[model samples]
Target chain A: MCATCGCGDDAGTRVSDLDGTVHDILPAAAAPHEHPHPHPHEHPHDHGHPHDHEHDHGHPRPQSPGTADAGHSPAAEGRTLISLEENLLAKNDLLAARNRGWLEGRGIQAFNVMSSPGAGKTTLLVRTIRELAGELVIGVIEGDQETSLDADRIRSTGRPVIQINTGAGCHLDAGMLQRALGALDPVPGSTLFIENVGNLVCPALFDLGESARVVVISVTEGDDKPQKYPHMFLAADLVIINKADLLPYVEFDVERCVRQARLLNPGVDVLTLSATTGDGMDGWLEWIRKNPHPAAAAAGSAPRSGGLRV
Target chain B: MHELSITQSLVEAVLDRTGGRSVTGVNLRIGPLSGVLPDAMRFCFEVVSADTPLAGATLTIDESEGRARCRSCRDEFVLEDMFLLCPCGSADVEVVSGRELQVTSVEVA
Candidate 1:
């Protein structure tokens, strides 16, 4: 029988023999090019699970054109063709919404810090925390693929820090930050800084429910860094060009970097400073001071419980 | 590199939608511009689904064609590559396709 839409004479006779049910059916010419038929082949089953074993035995019959291949089924292919426009980042978006609500309720101003691997983000945080230790109570959540090294560094400065190891994940999504936030002791009048994993790509795509996003790029990494990673530049509310003290010794073009970054994000605040030497630390600290937690301040917030002073 | 994590999430999403029913297959419509690699997703699926209910579940990938529409000429055409332009030699175009990534459907038993 010709098997396009299952409307062939043979299909009709076969259906008539079974029952007098006339369901909507597609014609052979209208059928998609691919036929749905299960191909018998040996599939690997290395995991020792009973569920895996059962699935291995019963493979579903494939569907029509562009549907029945080795990987996907007919129903799935039809859904894909038909307008199943699901958001790719639905999970992240849901968590982000929840995180935003949680932060707003607490009246804490949270910001996500992003940078290249050696962009002096930790050093900047160390200096900022130390300088603002008396006025702004600060808490930090550090993200890394491996090692608690960054968290340990922040701990040495005697600040409240929580370390999240993403294992192989490239960025810190809102869900991961939510878990980390629970572990962190609440500081009523404090600013929360989430040090995202050292990646310029995926971190930009994720919203960690931060009030602002800061991107740190070192001058030594060259002026084209912003142009190369425009997504990160576009997403950042603040851009810090670190390692400014090394510009004299290294052949780095600061102007070009600033120009390109401005082209991508016209309103992005760019700050150049040397974290090691504290050359531009005051300007950085001033920016943080301007962002006051009005809701917490208005509530006559009490001092948080057991938070480290810088 | 992060494909394994994404695959694990994909498996969990399928299971969640199925309400604990056994999934026979999972279909994903990944656009060329989604920045996700099909081969990497396939490789990670096996490792991610190991010992889970979705283990051994087939993964089907569908590639979407890159298309754009010219704003100036009001002409629609397929983009030859990443350069968004109209077939009538107009660079003033807006991309309409080739940036989709979704868990289209799942076969549950």
Candidate 2:
């Protein structure tokens, strides 16, 4: 959805890096031309667990490739049946897994940082990038419903950053991030941080093809954020409790919030840090250094639980 | 909500799967934890699928309950929210089947 009404008016997603290189992923109105060859390929009955990625056409540019081949079958009177047991988000997820493999193969780690508005996501990113300074070549893809305000902040840090204006959209989908990755082509061995549009619900649903997903929450918000928006925490490998400096004045409970976050994701690493005072910054920096591909830390085996406080 | 974009992707998936056939309806199994609202999907599918192969397609939604298993006691139960506890009172539960958004089948004409 364009985050706008389907009025059939002018609509597009704009992606631009700091150097003013822009690319517009035009609306579906112009989508027909892109489907040059609709080769039919019947998908197997995978139902809900779609993990087959063997259909590699060696398609050069994968921001969002053309769609073709697939079908479904169902019981209906006076109607034919085409059985298709797959997830609607299968396309996006498949593209995301492809992007993940590309990044992992090159030893490049990407982080999808998400949170509600004013959670200090941008601020925390600025601090983290500066602290990592000479250590890591960081590239950022900032997403917002409208402005490039956060992109400006990241640019001020002198790191490579691209801004994706979703227009009416609520969160950044894999297609959006995949296109952004094309613009902000961080070199191999570099880390890319995709700062997703400020949202807890929708952002969690769309995997931005990141090596790890980080959900940032501030103490200014309610401590019950995890309980209210469990999916965000559940999908995240790291939960940064930002704005710790305000904890003395705010009624937010750190222990309670961490416990709640842990309940949702037993494997999640919680870091209570103040981006303002640089207190507890090392812990997060350490996490970035040690396990760039945090998903790798979780994906291979049964989930593990451990608490390492700094 | 991103339901609009989701609905768009969903329609494309259905149309692509149909392979140029005239589709009548779609059967979906959506979990409560899938983050998709059945009513919103039903409402948006009409608009997003307009002018596409899936136009006039009905989206039949089947909401499945969230199920989780406790690692401690190996007990399985229905999970409603994040604050789920096992019958044996263990909070360390691994969600086995809650977040699902799949197209079970499609009726073609």
Candidate 3:
């Protein structure tokens, strides 16, 4: 049995040398002296040493049946035994927590707005900000895969805005939103709107730590959109059927869309509105006003629900 | 398109679970209506796992059949793509399966 570490009789005990090479000591009787090789041309034994080192320490040299190098083999095996039970999305969740705290600290209610490419999310946001400009301090975070075009549109309204270009990423994760939040310079008692990238499927999977998730589905799209994309409807706290002014020209059924959405999500609030004509804007604002963030209300001991945000 | 990002997340999840251990194979279940394309996911996995422990891991995907129940006819039938109609030719149908994306298991040593 090797005396270096404790490959001897007392196997359970830990042995330490002056050189900081900690090893497990096994009882000598428990250590069997079996032949290292059961097959020909196979490496007989592998001493617990790295492969690159050449200086041979005066240890019992097992016969080299074959020349298969076992360098870095022990380290690779050691990694398998490690129990690193960590959530894969822990980092993203950490950033999301920070964002939640930041939003709560400033009494700001953040909403994640998601929709298809041609859906008028930006236009609706612009109109809402314009109408509620003096009554509410609003900030916008525009997310897109490439350009700052959405942010530019929001900037035209003279509101504080930050643009986050995801480059090739399909959705804005919590980490990206956290960075965008910092750039927006969020003030206390403000309404922050995060216009997610123009995609329906991917954005529904990611949680940006928003108080509410509003999914905008344009009436120009087929009436069966809610049924086709049920996950988006299921994740949405509110569903907005935009481009209502075009309903007369397009073959769109507003009631059918609302019914399909409700079938998927019983509690989802459905609002039909045209961003261009500002029709049905009051319903959207009323819904937001009723659902004031809990953390913000608890901080100031305000009423649980009402037109708290003006 | 979005499946590529999800594929990257799956690779990351496998790497995180196996630590630095060399994974020989990864088994995943991809349903028919999961909105994730198996070919696209395999392509993305090959690129994302290049430097990670799952670099050479073989990806095994199990495909599921889309099944739905017709609300009007009360008949169950296999769906083809986005057509949620029952075999009895009814448009009112509720999906019962074929929208799953999950990591079933992994082989490592």
Candidate 4:
């Protein structure tokens, strides 16, 4: 099934390249992607017990006090209460960790760009690629429920791009990236931008193993967006106020939006820019140039959780 | 909703941990800032867990309040909403709790 939202079958999730070559993301057990790293599969705990207990379901088990109607109890007759203490998103987190390690190991700086639909994420990326054509090497991974339209736009910039259609899935999970990395194979020392599906809520919840998260909001989207989507802002490392050229016509309070974003994320960087008009584009480029690659900082540090399995 | 996916993950994790044993109860700890609605999760659990080892299992969610600690004044306080600001006028605050989404325990037979 779809790893992120589980609405459709896994066969619906797919990755397509500019050449029109499509790759199906199979179920986890028979996933087509291969692991480059030879790290062993690990779980928090694996309690192996012999299946010697008899199957006894004849009578109704005695329920604990106060749980008879609720059918919930810490201990029940002929039942084993196992304390799992496991994170619900453990599988996604594990895949994300592997992606992070692989990217950091190659000194690749990947940014997860998220915004609502029509927030101009593709516009910003296309502009960035054209402006910094020779100065930087950039690649992109476009995410959407369907269609390769955004990927085609990035392809026009002549950057290596891959499009992931989530089908019924609302957001892209780490598993999708893990599969895309095999195709993109981003060069070392290059920049990778993952354009997440246009949703303010679910995208922030999944960590795609990006070095940093960038949230883009346009002037037409109202200044109270930060207040409305606190999780997205709080998880953002930088917030780009796009479509700044419409500031005069629209009633977007830039100062108030920045203040609210900072309130949610104290250290978040806010930049105002109009991708179409090229106003304030220099600041955005400068921020990208100044941003440190996680690989460089983690050169001498111990590997997270012992080692990463990619 | 995202809760559907989350509920699926919860059921899968419990089944994997319990080795596909018949489960009667699954306890979860959800924090307010985790971006998950407990009611939606409960509903999704009932839908996804059907016909699986967790069929008819009760999903007990323990919702926790958002808590944070101010880095400037070292004061800990509750976050009534999404704002991370502290009473001392310092926006530099660290979330100490309320982002939990874990399966604490499961009753399997």
> Highest lDDT among the candidates is held by which one?
4
The reply for model 1, stretches above 4 Å from the true place, is: A1-85, A291-310, B19-25, B31-35, B50-99, B107-109
Q: Write the per-residue lDDT of candidate 3 for residues A1-310, one digit (tens) a residue.
A: 2111112233222322222232343233443222112112233334466332232334323223222222212213322221222322334445555667778787888888999998999999999998887888898988776666777788888887877656556777675676556546778888989999899887775666677789999988989998887767767789999989999999999899987887666567899999899899999988878768645474422211100100
Model 1 chain A lowest lDDT segment of ten? A301-310
Candidate 2, residues A1-310, lDDT tens digits: the string is: 3322221224567888667565566344532212222323455545365343343333221112122223233344545544566676765666566567667666678888999999999999999999999998898999887778889999999999999987777788666766676667778888888998898888887765677778999998989999998878878889999999999999999999998887767778999999999999999999988874534443421111100010
Model 4: colliding residue pairs: none
lDDT of 4 at A9: 64
lDDT of 1 by residue, A117-191 (tens): 889888889888888888888888887766667777888878878776655467777666665666675576579
Candidate 3 chain A, which ten residues in sequence have the lowest lDDT sum?
Answer: A301-310
Candidate 4 lDDT, tens digit per residue, A104-170? 9888988889999999999999999999999889999999988899999999888999999887778
Task: Give the Cα error of residue A10 in candidate 1, in Å.
Answer: 56
Q: Tell me the deviation in Å of residue A164 in model 1.
A: 2.2
List residue ranges in candidate 3 displaced over 4 A: A1-94, A296-310, B16-20, B29-39, B61-105
CAPRI-style grade of the A/B interface in model 2: medium
RMSD of 1: 17.8
Chain B of candidate 1 vs. true chain B, TM = 0.88
Task: Report the poorest 10 consecutive residues by lDDT, candidate 1 chain B.
Answer: B13-22
Task: Rank the models by TM-score, top first.
Answer: 4, 2, 3, 1
